[model samples]
Target: MKQSGNSLIEFLLVTVVILAVTASILALAGQTDKKRVNEELSDLATLTATAERALGMPQGHYEGLPGKLIDEKLVPAKMVDSAGHLQSRWGPVNLVPIDVGAKRLAGYSITYTNVPSPACPLLVKGGPKDKRSIRVDSVEVGSFGNINASALAQACSKATVSITFEHHLNEPGKRSL
Candidate 1:
């Protein structure tokens, strides 16, 4: 009877230790994810600044901006994989020109696809504030002004999401909203 009681206690202790270790590992993983998300946001900010500089140049347009950025080595090396394709934390990063009107390419849009739902709010909240518009899965959640947190949260409630950051040129060599 005494040996059985000791064995039971040992089993309970080992189970408790296992549970604690699992909890610690989960917490550490959460922290790591947060750190990675912050890194991605920083990279996005750098890319946006680079695009703005390109827009301010003599051409003053977004035509072929993605290729230009890649060819000129303006994009951060970390964002590009071995195949030279831009990648975000969750998936591919696409940079394309935005046609304002009359076949005029006046701006650029950065789209990050296959984004996990939890990262949606973080991306929107931490994204560049000077963007002309922000969209989640083809729905415009914010534009030319402060983004509504509630709207963003609602829009981002999905298994996977796509976020687009659109930057527009108000005039030649000038950025607006």
Candidate 2:
């Protein structure tokens, strides 16, 4: 009579195959996340610089103000990402209204935004104390390319790509909730 030794060997082989498949899946997932993180970092750098640069020039009540940095030259009306999310091609990364505390017409506040602001919140009114405050939405990068459309359009989308922004209020004491 044949022993059941063959059954044990078959079981070992199946286990090995399962482990290999699992390992492969985990590796792929990791690679994808890495790629996304890198992309988010790089993209954020570009957007932040661009937005900051735009803050340099003085703007009018209705007319758009100039940027602090114009790498490509001239503010664009809008900029679209690979997924079609847009930034103002010509305007600031994002816009904020004149605040009451502002020393000038507007103070561009890019420090608070770690990454570039999103394409939405067309206009953000400044705080009562500061006139020159523009709040660019935070940009988040996820492993997946399809960030929710609303998030892409709005700064608060909460994409996987997270950013920490820093800001120094011109009139912190005057700020209201």
- 1-177 per-residue lDDT for model 2 (tens digits): 145788888889999999999999999976765554454344445554444444433332212322323334443323443433334322223333233344444333332232323322211211112222233344441111223334435654433222223222233443311
How badly does each model clash, as a count of residue pairs?
Answer: 0, 31
Show model 2 residue runs off by greater than 4 Å: 1-3, 57-84, 87-164, 167-177
- Across 1-177, the per-residue lDDT of candidate 1 in tens digits comes to 999999999999999999999999999988877887899999999888888786645554787767777878898888887887888878999988878776478778999999888788888888987777899988888876478778788889999999999877774444453
lDDT of 1 at 88: 88
| TM-score, candidate number 1 | 0.89
C-alpha lDDT values of all predictions: 0.83, 0.37
List CA RMSD, all candidates: 2.6, 11.4
Report the poorest 10 consecutive residues by lDDT, candidate 2: 119-128
